[model samples]
Structure formats: C-alpha cells, structure tokens
Target: MGKPISGSAADNSDVSFGLTLMAIAVLIAPLIDIFSKLAIATIPSGQITAIRFTLQVLFILPVVALRGALFDLTWKKTALHALRGVLLVATMLSFITTLKVMEVADAIAIFFVEPIILTILGSIFLKETIGWRRYTACGVGFFGAMLVVQPSMQEVGLIALLPIVSAFTLAVFLLVTRLVAQSEDPWSMQFHAGIWGALFSAALLYFGEGTGSDVFDPVVPDALSLVYVLGVGVAATISGVLGVYAYRAAPASVLAPLQYLEIVSATLFGWLVFNDLPDALKWLGISIIITSGLYIIWREHRLNKTAGTAPVSPAI
Candidate 1:
C-alpha cells in the first residue's frame, strides 16, 4: 500500500492549490474593471455598484444553499458580513469612479497600493511585527503609487485620489475578512456580503440620485449596457470566491505579491479595449511599486523561514 501523505505534505499541497486559485482570481479581477468601465460609459457608478452586488448575491445564493451552509449564519456573523460589505461597496465605488475618468491601467496601478497599506494595517491593527526593511519598502511602494497618480492628476483632478481611498478601505476589508474567515464558509460570506453591499449601494443610489452628484446619479441601461453590468457581476463573483479561498489556504504573504498580476492584466485590457497605455514615467512607477511589493513579500518569507514560523493572517 502507498504510504499516507505527511501533514506537511498536505499543507504544501493546499498552499499550491491556494496559489493557483489566487492566480486565477488575479487574472479574472481585471475583467471587473473592464466591464465597469464599459458599463459606466452610460450607467452611473452607484447604479453599477448596486447591480454588481445584487447579481453577486443572486449568483452565489444557490451555491451556498447547495453547500448546506445557510444554517451557519448568526446575528453577529451577519452584522460582521454587513460591515465588510459596506467597506467593499466603498472600495468598489471608489475604484469604479476612478475608472470612469482615468485609464483602467492607471487606476489599477494606484489601487495596487493595497498591499503596502495592508502591511501597515497588519502591523498596527493585527499587531504583526514589521522590520525596517518592510517598512521602507512600503514607503517606496507609496512613492510609486504617487508617480502613477501625478501626471493624471492634472486631468482627472481629485478623482485620482479615489484609488488611494479604495486601497485603504480594501485593506480594512481584508483585515475584517481574516477575522471571520475561519468560522464562515467562503460561499456564505460571499452571499451575505453581496446582499449587504447591494442594499447599501441601493440606499446610496436612492439618496444621491437627484442631489446633482454625478457620481451617485442613477441611469437606466440599454440592453447592451445590461450585458456589461451582468459581466461585472459575474466577474466580481468569481474573483471574490477565488480570493476568499486563496487566502484561506495560503498565507497572505504568499499571495499578496501575486496580486500584482492584476495590473498587467489591467494594462493589457486597457490597451486592447480603450487604446489606453501608460506613459514611460507611469511605467517606471508601476515597476517600482511592483518591486517594492515583491520585496516585502520576499522579506516576510525570509523572516518566517528564519524564525520557523507561519505567516500571520490575511497577507492582503
């Protein structure tokens, strides 16, 4: 008979599978930006955010039912899910708003600061230790994000700051996600979050529609626009599921750097769909941001190796 797999071997296998899932998530995530960009050509960002989450709830409900996970819900868990959903709505609203006025690649490049933000938040809120090297890398990553934002600021004005806000909210979202991840299945969490996000966005749409705020105004979508909205929903659902499971199976440090892959996908999609390309300076900033993020991941891995310790939760 073949020998049983060792515990460490099983763990390694899970990590490999998780990383594979993360890569898939990263690849598909850019589609949300692409579809949102297309949809918002006519649809308002608030409406788009509402439809995306409503569809996510519809898409994931059956999966949660099939998994027999609905009974796992508690008031506390439900409330936590709602709070996470609010943060996610903020993250999406900010990002999609940026996409409305900026190139997809540039907006995404600025949002890639999430990892750096995550590092700092992890150290503060999660009480994780960070050495000077990782701290310095975070600063470098922020500079790179600034580089991506500078040239476009003249045209987009304050809209360029939206992605930075997105990064901050996303970092907080992931931190909360880590806290609840162990108790809730990914499907259930996704379902509850979708419901809460849809409701929150609908409220925003209701309150802001006639308020002369262009970002919050509602617009009716034509048939083709409906297709774009549904595409954003589907892409977001897939990305959320994959991301939740990826973080569950692997350390955040292992998966955080891989998040950079989305920028490449975003750049490609932007060029193909919108004829948008980053300038040389923007490219330089992107390269630096990518480098800094990867260096932090590498430093964490080395430290963990030396200390013989596993990484902390939610690597971002």
Candidate 2:
C-alpha cells in the first residue's frame, strides 16, 4: 500500500480557517440578536427590521446597480420572492419579540425545532424520503425542544407561541429558499427581501401609529445603545455571509450539528451579557435538541452513503 498522504499546507490552512469561520459565525448570531432587542426596546420591531433591511439595501446598491436586473422581477419569481419576503419579516419580528421577552438560551433552544419542521416539509413537498430512523430522530429533537421551552403548566402564555410561529415562518422561508435556489442570485434575493421587508414594516408602522404615510421618525438614540444596534447589524451581516460560505464549503450533514454549537455560544452570551441562565429542564431540553440534530445529520450521511447519493448542500 502507498504511504498515506498528508494534506498540503494550504489545504490544512483552508480547512482550519473555514471551520473557525463557521463556528464563530454560529456563535455571533445570539450576540447580534441581543443587540437587536436593545434596538427594538427603543424603536418598534417594524422600524428595527426596516432599518436593518435599509442598511442591507444600501450596502448592496452598487452591486445591484452593476447587475442591471436589480428591479426586473419576473412575475413568478416576484410572487415567490414576495411570499418569502413576508415570511422573512414575520420571522425577524417575532424572533425579536421573543428575544425581548424570553431568555436568549430558551429562545435559541426552542428555535432548534426548525430543522425538524424542515425535514417534515421536505418529505411532504420536496418528495424527499426519510427513513424511520430519521423520523425517530426528528421526534426526539422535537421532544428536546419542548424540554427547552417546557411549555407544560403555567409557563405557556400567548407570547410563548411566538417562538413556534417564528420557527414555522422561518421553515417556510427556508423552503422557498430551496425552491428559488436555482433562479435567484444572492444579491437579488437580498434585494427583494429588503424592499419587501421595508415596505411591510412601513405599513405596520403606519397602522400602529394610526397615521397615513409618515412611518419613520428619526429620534436621537442613546449613544452607546445606538452604537450597539449598528454593531448588531454589522455582526448579523457578517454571520449571514459566513453562513453562505459555510454551506458552500461543507455538506449540510457536516455543518448541521456545528450549528448546535450556537447553543453553547448563546448560553455563554446569555449568562455573561444578559445574566440569563438555562434552567435544569431547559438544559435537559437543549441536550435533547443537540443529540437529535447530531443524529439526524449522521443518519442523513449514512443514508446518502448507502444510496450512493451526494449531499445536496454543504453543512450550514
């Protein structure tokens, strides 16, 4: 047998740095979200979302202009994009509301149900076959999610449903993302989402204020807090870009469990930044979520291997 080959220095470096980038990006999400809550404390969730989308639009304007098809929306793609845009805005606003009210770790843990929902939807819509093992994994994951949220007894409230709504909306957004993947470029998708989000947020603001068209009001923000909001926007953008790169670099099986690392990061951020600690039940719940997610990924890889099929997307 030939001697085992060592990876080249560049290959090793690339792998190392790529993994680092993915991990850090996952961790950054909760931190950015915490800042979003601070921003939302002053501005309405609608306005916060509007500003975030506005910044994204401004940041991407030069590229969109160069691309030329910026506003060209094909009717079918426009409809799909609009649907996705509404889901995106709903997910953001609901999630922000959850963050404002709930513990960060709890919210993060509850949101872990997303992949489970996606798996079910994939089976239903994409005609993707899932084995009994994967189904069991999904079930276990959902149970763990409940443990994290611990919805039993009096803990359940009207607002408690927000995380579930956020997850469902986000799953729809992800489904649309899969559908639009072949047609939409990242910039165009972002542009569509931004414009739609801005429009919807403006409408919400108008309705909430009981006014006509004047939606946005520029108020002098508390200095440090304004800086924090900007920081959140920047961090979210960076994390979002990193997620795209991570998906490109690895299979979803490889990347999916790495996403569970966010729980660790969120736990730390919650404790240190917000003094929010996970309770025993919540911890137990998160453990379930982590195990289920890791198992689903492993089961997925095993299925692909046995069937001689390649992964659809790299781990994200």
Return the TM-score for each candidate structure.
0.89, 0.84
| Count: clashes, candidate 2 | 7
**Cα RMSDs of all predictions?**
3.7, 5.1
Backbone collisions counted per model: 1, 7
Which regions of candidate 2 fall more than 4 Å away from where they truly are? 1-17, 66-72, 151-156, 211-225, 305-316
Colliding residue pairs in candidate 2: 250-314, 250-315, 251-314, 251-315, 252-314, 252-315, 255-315
Off by over 4 Å in 1: 1-16, 245-251, 305-316
Candidate 1, residues 1-316, lDDT tens digits: the string is 9999999999999999988998888878888889999998898888988988888878877888999996688888988999988998898888888888999999888887787898899899988899999899999999999999999898789899999998898888878977887788877877887888889999999999888776788877899999999888888767877877887798866777677888888889899999999999999999998898888878878877211111111111
Global lDDT of each candidate: 0.82, 0.69
lDDT of 2 by residue, 39-152 (tens): 766655666666676666666677778988597678888888888778877887787777766877788788777777777777899888998987998899888877766553
User: How accurate locally is residue 27 in candidate 2, as Cα lDDT from 0 to 100?
Assistant: 78
Clashing pairs in 1: 252-315
Best by the lDDT measure: 1
TM for candidate 1 is 0.89
